[model samples]
Target chain A: MNKPASLVVLDLAILIDMYGDDSADTICPALSRFRSEASKYINQLQHAVVQQDHAEIARLTHSLKSMAGLIGACQLMEWSQLVEQAAKQRDQTMLANHLPELTTIWAALQTELASSLLLYGSADA
Target chain B: MTLTRNIHVLVVDDVILMCDFLYGVVNKVAGCRAIKALDGKAAAEYLGNERIDLLITDIEMKAPSGLELAQRVRSGMFSQTPYDIPIIIFSGNAYREVIEQSIAFDVNDFLVKPITSAGLTAKIQYHLQHKKVLKPMSHYAQLVADVDYAKAIELPTEDRAFSVAIVRELPEPKADDVDQREAASKAKEKKEKKEFLVWPEHATTGYFQLDRRMRNFAFNVSCFHNVFVENCKPVAIESERKRACEAADYLFHISKNIKQKDNRRDFWLLFQQRLDKLQPHVKELNSINIKHHSQVLVLLKRLAYWWMQTCSRPLIQINEVTHETADE
Candidate 1:
C-alpha cells in the first residue's frame, strides 16, 4: 500500500510518544474518546456557524484547539486557531468557509484512529 | 543563596492530559515537586493550602482563569505572601490579546504549549533564582531615602531577602498638557501607592547638576513603561523609544548610583521583559514608516546593551566593595 502523505495523516509514532504507546492501554482509548466527542464538537460548530453565533464558534473552536494540541493534531489545532481568530473578529464569511473542514478532519481522524485501535486490539488478543 | 532542597510548583490546566504532561515535566527537575490542578478553582484551593513556591498555569480554565489567578497573586488577594509569587502562563493559545492580558496581569513569564522539559525548567529556575535575590522596595527606597549608599553597598555576611520591593510603586510624573487627557483615560486606578526611589534632602550623586538629570531619566523611563504597557498606547512609540535611549545614556553617566545603591538584580529582569515587550508595540506603530521602525529597532538594540551593562557590571563593584572590606 502507498504511504499516506506525511502532513495530512496522523503520525502514529508521535501519537504513541505523546499519548504513551499505540496499545489499548494508551493511544487506543484516547483516540476512542476523541472520536466519540469530535462529532459533537463538529455538530456544535456547524450549528454555531449556521446561527452566526460568533461567541459560540469561538468557544467551540477554543476547546477543539486545546484538545487538538494535546493529541498532537497540528492541522486541526491550527485550523481551529484560524477559525477562532475569525470568530473573535466576527468575520462571518471566514467562519462559514472553514466550518466544513472541521467535519472533514473529524471524519478522517476517526477512521484512522479506529483502524489503529483495531490493529492494536487484535495484536493484544 | 540558600534554597529549600525541594521547590514546590503547582501546574494548573483544565485538561487532564495537559496537566499530567506538565506535572511530569516539572517533576523531572531533580529537586522539584510538582502538583496538578485540573481547573482554576482547584488551583486556588491548592494555593490556599499548599506552600507552592511557583505557579505554572493555563489561561483558559474554568472561572477565575489563570490570568485572574495571576492578578490575584499580584494584588495580594490570596494573602499568601507580601512578595509576588512568580507566575508562568503556559497556554496553547498565545493570541495577541492573551499576551496583553498576561502582561497587564503581571505574569513573570509566558510560555506557549508543547514546551520542552528543558525550556520549562529553565524559566522556572530563572524566576525562582531571581526571587531569592530581590528585596522589598522599602529596603532600597529606605536606603536611598536616607542617602546611605555606604550601607546599601555593604556585602552582608548573611544573605538578605530584600532589595527593590516598590519597583511598581513609582508615581506618574506630572503629564504634559497634550498627555493629560490620554493619561487620565489610560490610567489604571491605583489602590495604594508608595514612593519607590526617594532622594534625601540635599542629596547629590557627587555631581550636583547630574542628580537632576538622573532623577528625570529614571522617572521618564518609568513613566514611559507605565504609559506604553499599561495604557496601551503605541502612537507614542517614537518619543518613548527616544526616552529609552536617553535613559540608557543617563544610566551610563550616573552608573555609580545604580551600581552602588541598587542591590537587587530583579529590576533588570523586568527591564529585559519591558525591552522585549516593546516588539509588539513597535509592530503596532502602523502610522510610522519602515525607516522609523528600523531606527527604533537599532536604538532598542543599543539600549539593551546599555541596560545589560548597567545591571551586570554592578557585580564587579560589589566584588570591589567586598575586597575593600576584606582588606580593612
Candidate 2:
C-alpha cells in the first residue's frame, strides 16, 4: 500500500508516443546545454572581473540571471541579482563580497548539474 | 520493459518552481509523459482528454484544492475507472490522520515536496513492479475454479530430484437454473484453491538437491503440508515489470536495508534452514486473499530467488502461496 516518492516523478513517460523521437531527444540535450552555457557565462563573468570590465560583467550577469531563473537555480538567481546591482553602481566592495557567494553558488550548481545531466542521459538513452 | 509507456502523469502545484522541478525529473523517464498544471483547474482540464497513469499532486492549490479534486474523483459523477490510475498526494503538510484517511480513499503513495530522485524512483518502480507480477496472477486467477487445492504431497530424498507436480483442478461448470447457479457458485467458492503460481527464475523444477540423504527441497503447499519452505514471500507490492527487474538488481547491494538473503549458506545446512524458515510462513503468505495478494506474491517469488542465489543450496521451491479457484 505504501510506495516511494520517485514514482511520482517518472509518471511522465507519454511524450515518446505523442511527439516521436525528436521531441524525445530534446530533454537531455536541453538540460545539458542549459547547464553548459551557464557555466560558460559564469566563466566569462570571472574573466570580466579580472580585466575590470564593468560593462561586460553587468551584461553577462543580467543574462545569467534569466538563465538561472529558467533552469530553476534557486539561490544562484537570488545572488546574481545583487552582483548585477553592484556592477551598475561601480561599487568594488559589493562586487568583492559577491565573489565568495558566487563561488559557493557555482559549486552547488556543478554538483546538481552533474546529477541532473546524468539522470537525463539514462532516461534519454 | 516499457509497461507504462503511454501512461499519463499529472503534475500539480501552486508554485511553478516545484511543478517544473517535478516535471523535469519525471519527464525524462521512458514510457511516461507528464502534464503540467499550476492549479486544480489546470489539472482537471488535462484529465478531460488524457488518461493519467499516476497523479503527483500538491495538496494546497488555490481554488479547488487537491483534497477537493480527490473528492471529486471519488464521486461516481466522474469516472477515472477505465484507466484505474493510481494517485499520489504530494505535500509539505504534517496531518497524519488526514493522510491516513486519504489512504482510506485509496490514494497510492504519499510524497513530501522537495523530493529526491532516489526516493521518487524507488516508489514509482515499487508500484509498477507490483503491477507487473499481478498480471499473471490475475490472468491465472480468472481461470481457476474451486477444487481441493492441497495437491498430494511428495517427499523424496535429495538423491534424485523428486517430481512434485501441483494439479490445480479446474472449477466445475456453472449450473444452469437460478437455484443451481447459486448453489453451485457457493459450492465452488468453498472448494477453490489459490489459483495462481509464480515460478522463480521460471525454474523448470521447483526443487533441486544439495545432498542425497534427505529431500533438500521440501515444498510445503498452503493447501497441504509435510513440504518445506525456504524464505519469506516475494514482495507482493504492485509494480511495473521494468522496475521489479531493476529492484532485483539490488539483491547484490551489500546494504542490510533489504531483508532478502544475498549471502551464501552451506549445502547440507540449506535443508534444515529452509524447512525451519519456510514451514512457518506458508500459511501466513498463503493468506494471499489477506489484503494485497499481488505484493505478497512478488515478495514470495523474489524471496525464492533470494534464497536460491544466497543459500549454499542452488535451488528453492515454493507453492500454494495463494489459493483462488477458477472453476466456479
Candidate 3:
C-alpha cells in the first residue's frame, strides 16, 4: 500500500503527545484495536441504517464519533457527528445521503491506520 | 495529602477501546493503578472487593448507568468501600438532562468526553488530593425525585419558557464589611478540623484479644451507622444492628477482665454503661420502625465517639506509666 504524501485521515501527534516518546509501542496496539472496533461499529451502523433503526444508528454513530475524536480522526469524527445528529432528529433523507460518504471516510481511515500500524511494527497487523 | 498506598482508579465504559485508552492513561501516572470495567455491573463488582480510590465512568450504559453507579456508591450500597468515593462522569455529549442528572447524583465532577491525557491526569491528581464530602442520603433521594418529576411533566413549549424576575438588588459590601468577611473566613478555617472516629494506631490496647474485639465492635457500629444513614432495607439494618450488639456485648464482657487504675476504671465503667444503653436500641430494632431510626442513629453516633475515646485509654495509661517512671 502506498502511503499518502500527506496523511489526512489519522493524525497521531495527539497520541504521541499523550503517551510521550515511547508512544509507538502503545499507539500501535491501540491503532490495531481501533481498526477492529471501528470496523465492527461501522458495519453495525450500516445495518442499522438499512433497517431504519434510528436509535441504533444514533448509538453506533455516537460511539464512532467518540472513538474517532479520541484518536484525532478529524474527518471521520465530523462525519460521525453529522450522522449521529441526523439519526437523533430522525432524518432518514439526510442519513441516506451521508451514509456513503461516511463509509468512504471510514475506509480511508482504516487504510491510514493499517499503514501507520505497519510503520509502528504492529505484530497483529 | 499524599496517599500512602497506590491510587486505584476504576474506569468503566461500555466501549472497549475507550476503556483501554483510559486504562493506559491512568497507568502513565506514577503511583496510580487503573482497573477497567466494561460496564457498570463489572465496575460495581470491582468496587465491592477492591480498594478503589476514584471512579471515572461513562454516563450512558446498559442497565445501571453511570449515574446509577454513583447513586449506589453515595447510598452506601457497596459495603466494602466508603460511600463518599469521588466519582467523575464523562461522556461525549454533555446534554442539559445529563448534566442535571449528574448533579442530582452528587458526582464529584463531570467531563465532556474526547478526554485528553493531560486533562484526565489533572482531574485524577486533583481528586486524589481532595476527598469528596457526601451529602445526606435524603438530599440525594430528593434530588433524584425532583429530576424524575421534572422529566415526567413536560409543559408546552410556550409554558416551558420563563424569565427570572429579580425582586431586589443587594448593595455592594462596604470596606469594613469586607474586612469582617475576611476575618470570619479565617476564623471558620481555623475552626475546621478532621475528626478521627477510630485511630487504629492509638486504639491498640496491649491485650490482643481486647484490641481485636474493639476493632470488630467499631466495624459493626460503622456498618450499622452507614446502613441506617442510607435508609437501607429493614433486613440490612436488623442484620447490622444484631452484629453490632453481639460485638459490643463481647467487648464489654472482655473489658471486665482487664485491671485498670482507679481513674481509668471510671472510664471503663462509663464505656460499659454506654454499651449497656445500646442494648435497648438493639432490642427495639428487632421490631424496627421508621420512628426509631433517628433515635437509634443518634445513640450509635454517641456510642461510636465514646468507643474511640475508650480505645485511646490504653495509650493514656502507657503515657502515665512512663511519666511515673521518669519521676522515680
Q: Give candidate 3's error at residue B222 in angstroms.
A: 62
Worst 10 residues of 1 chain B by lDDT: B319-328
Off by over 4 Å in 2: A1-125, B80-83, B131-328
| DockQ of each candidate, alpha-carbon based | 0.05, 0.01, 0.12
Per-residue lDDT of model 1, residues B148-259, tens digit only: 5434433221132212211111223466786785756454222102211122222232333344554565455445444444444565744764674575456445543543
Residue A13 displacement in candidate 2 (angstroms): 26
Scoring only the A-chain of each prediction against the true A-chain gives TM-scores of 0.78, 0.71, 0.85
Q: Which tens-of-lDDT digit does each residue in A1-65 have in candidate 2?
A: 00111011111121221122324254455445556777788889889999988767866775565
lDDT of 3 by residue, A60-85 (tens): 98788778766757567667766765
After TM-score superposition, what is the CA distance of residue B10 in candidate 1 from its true location, in Å?
1.9
* Two-chain DockQ for model 2: 0.01
* Candidates' C-alpha lDDT: 0.54, 0.45, 0.64
Scoring model 1 with DockQ, what do you get?
Answer: 0.05
lDDT of 1 by residue, A46-107 (tens): 88878888877877777776666555564576577667756765666866777667666666
Error of 2 at B39 (Å): 0.8
Error of 1 at B103 (Å): 4.0
lDDT of 3 by residue, B1-328 (tens): 4456688889998889899888988887777899999988999999889878788999877767887788777767776767778898887654444555566667888775556787688888888788767788767656545766556422112122111100101232354677797886675444322221342433333345566676677677677777877889978887887887788777767666553422333233334544554566555544555458665754654454344223322112122221111100
Ranking by DockQ: 3, 1, 2
Give the winner by TM-score: 2 or 3: 3
In model 3, which regions exceed 4 Å deviation? Answer: A1-7, A18-22, B145-328
